[model samples]
Target chain A: MGMTFTSNVLKDGLSRIQREIDAAFDAQLPVPDDMSASLVEAMRYAAIGGGKRVRPLLVASVAELHNGSREQAVRAGCAIEAIHVYSLIHDDLPCMDDDDLRHGKPTLHKKYDDAIAVLAGDSLHALAFDLLASPEMSNDPAVRAELVHALASASGHKGMAGGQVMDIAAEEAGGDLDLHTITRLQQLKTGALLGAAVEMGAIIGRVPSEGRSHLRNYARDIGLAFQIADDLLDVEGDEEAAGKALRKDDAAGKQTFVTLMGAEQARAQASALADQAIGHLSAYGSEADILRELARFIVERDR
Target chain B: MGMTFTSNVLKDGLSRIQREIDAAFDAQLPVPDDMSASLVEAMRYAAIGGGKRVRPLLVASVAELHNGSREQAVRAGCAIEAIHVYSLIHDDLPCMDDDDLRHGKPTLHKKYDDAIAVLAGDSLHALAFDLLASPEMSNDPAVRAELVHALASASGHKGMAGGQVMDIAAEEAGGDLDLHTITRLQQLKTGALLGAAVEMGAIIGRVPSEGRSHLRNYARDIGLAFQIADDLLDVEGDEEAAGKALRKDDAAGKQTFVTLMGAEQARAQASALADQAIGHLSAYGSEADILRELARFIVERDR
Candidate 1:
């Protein structure tokens, strides 16, 4: 069943979302025939042709479960992906993570200059909110406002960015961070955006806050499993398959789930978490099959 | 009358807005007792106790002219100011403008490390939309969405960031950019946000798109005058009073309004534009007196 799910539903969803995200960015950012052309080009270069499109997939799958509009879900997914891509671009900057490769291509700062990279990242950050707030995202202004608020809160200082600060500090702390500290860091850094991805789908589905506990729990579990799997990948996964540098955590002496727990324990923990994540959706029948498959894939996939 | 306006109304308005913006940042971003403290501190450092608070003042004044609530206008103003402050932080990065001083102090990157500066700016960028879409900004969701849309549009690739690209291109083109191109650059770079400042205020007051022509014209005229005055300041103003490095445009061999038209002509154009900006507000009587004074003050102020 897991193999069938990966080859069918999840595969179809990923490809469809990848195409939708590229098309959305292509349509939204037409390079002007003027001096500012390079800025738009840089934005397109970084945004249009990259990444797993996982956030969009999550939004689409969750929204589908709720019988929400596919178009609106895709649009919202694009907004979330924009924020994700922008964060990646900034994180790869020379002063940040100093990454050279992203999605098997040169990082934005390496491809363009640092100034263009910064501006492009900033533009994408603004573009996310613009996409969310635009009338085309949803006819209902309340829905649009809610979407903007959710993305903004998740992306801001107390969420993704704040988590990054903790990650950096963890690196400087020389791998002394405990399990609780590291878990808090990952929750803010990666967990907030992932949680928001599920929450946003629920928002599109008109699911109230009080009714989203199961989905939230599912997201939380998957988020940690995803991070733990990423740590395992850094230690054992192929750089070619990952399409980027790996083992940098060990080089930087950063304390990660694998570093603290050892690979065997971390891998076991990830599998357990993935199973827990899948169980959270027991309330639904096969309608949540893709989500359950996603949980399995999170810990099982090479990348 | 102009003297009375500046010393009384505008003066009070400026100080009041400065306090409001500072207080808003202080209240919104309390430093956490953890590793993320530096990130929040960096955001607060750059956002508080800086600049002229011109954007906030514009929002407050225009919203008042439209009989909008003071508190709501102030909140919206803080959002605009956040965007402005974030732009400044990014612009001052070593990879960008490489400036050392801003608002009479070390730039964000100079004060904090480059990575923190980048994250702080990105966080503040998210914070702008967060503030705009928050329930406190407006009771009507449509209004909050409109505010977010207006700001996001003004700050993205085709707007402020786009203008920055053109400005960089102009520098590479070696002071040969035509007046039309320069005007277009300034329109996007500075004019867009200035225009959005008034547009947002009108949005807060529930002014429909069709009803904002006069205000749009008022904003447009003042926007140009503001940039021209900035160019003049860069040429002849005291760096001490300006609180930033001046004459750098000339050093970079960039074409500015003053460079292209000569200081005398640029000064004349700015004064004319200011008058033209004030003339657009002729529909209102004493209710617009502050705005009229602001227009005059735009071209007349030394820094």
Candidate 2:
């Protein structure tokens, strides 16, 4: 019956992974002088520009709990973040989400040119696969393969792409859509990656298969909750506080949980999902406390 | 000297892989009963549309040549093509390359909205990784890991992105770039993937380290030759023949080999490179005949 919010609940994990990602970006930069300048700029822009390092931190914490070495966990975390950052860069292109604002600043394409943004995103994606398959993860090939599969599934169409397709279709249709359809679309598009983050940590940690199943379930619940909260935020959040536009969902003629089920109901559902997600942590004992806090953080964040 | 143009090189391979990719797409499609009409149309417009299937075919061919089974190679090839297609979609975005043409038709974003283009590209990317890591690649953990590493490196900042960066910067600088710089850029941007294609085949085939080295070298040379020929075509070929605008290099202020060395020299260089690439196949004897033919095909293509 007791839950304490540790201000630095995942600080060591976050900082360590952030440091690793920073080093990777740095090492990858100052590329050969003969290289294209746009590519160099794009890589630097996508990899180094500041953002909340939440995903990387989550990976590290989950890996640690699953008994993976910090070194391995941190590297995997960095790899996942690379994928995340890459997706954002591509998403922000004038063609995709077309938003100028990301994390309260210009998206990569906006800051650079569209070509750089596209190339940068592409490179980040490549970097992700390389890092996972690198010797940094483990000498054990099985562990490495598991991690690769988990990451790939999250990044690709059946997961993220499938979700995106659904969202686009929904938008074009531009009429009343049921909450179920919206949630399903969000789950595939956004939830898949988030869930994969947690699941990948378990895979890398070599957690028992049964325990991995429980952790994935935990991830799934929170991932959905995270999306629902995001949808709610778009409706209720302040633009400055959220670090992006508000009510743009309505502007886009997109249907969200808030639009389909009303804001009050969406809030209730998100809380319920978060609580459900946290409940699954009982299976992990104290090892999963950090994860529970992360679930709460997902819904609580304004930006 | 005896080369007949037969498009059926990977015909069997393409048919098999194409079927799989189509199935994957079908399984992922939102049931028509689930949403409004426009969203489904956008999804279909992006995913169901087609291309020449070059990237995947390369993967399958390379993988089979090295040691892997045709079936396995086909899957890997399809995955690589997905990544390539994803890149093309994003690159053609209005914010990026902004080309109105693709595969002799309107680009994805042109047919659909910018948002759909972005999401589709992203989906394809995620799908590629998923395919690489899927059970289809292998039950063997080490093989899957190898596949992931090969594909990721080709796609990432250090490889393709690095190449793209060099390309954009050189173009923007708008001056005579040395052969070394230009070659490096072209190699990294285009050759890297081609090299990766060959490498993926080697990994799938479980080719010996030495053989892989030789194969990779051959692939790099051929890849560059392919690009050089492409540059030549832009300068000399008809727009209708090329299926896109010609003389884009001059218009974009880009520095191609032709721009640096002039037409005749560039043509001679390409021929020399193609010969060098063919020479690498001496070790494989008849096993590499198709590859040898491909090398010739690279320079011979008018478009």
User: DockQ of all candidates, in order?
Assistant: 0.93, 0.57
Tens-digit lDDT track of model 2 for A154-272: 76655676676677678877876777778788887788777778877777677766867767778888888888888888887888877766787899998888788888888888888
Tell me the docking grade of candidate 2.
Answer: medium
Candidate 2 to truth, TM: 0.89
- In terms of lDDT, model 1 sits at 0.91
Off by over 4 Å in 1: A1-5, B1-5
State which candidate has the highest lDDT: 1
Per-residue lDDT over A35-126 for candidate 1, one digit per residue giving the tens place of the 0 to 100 score: 99999999998999867887888888888899889999989998999999999999999999999998888999999999999999999999
* Residue B234 CA displacement from its true place in model 2, Å: 0.9
Candidate 2 DockQ, CA atoms: 0.57
TM-score of each: 0.98, 0.89
> Which lDDT value does model 2 have at B198?
83
Number of residue pairs clashing in candidate 2, backbone atoms closer than 3 angstroms, sequence gap of 3 or more or interchain: 18
Which candidate's DockQ is highest? 1
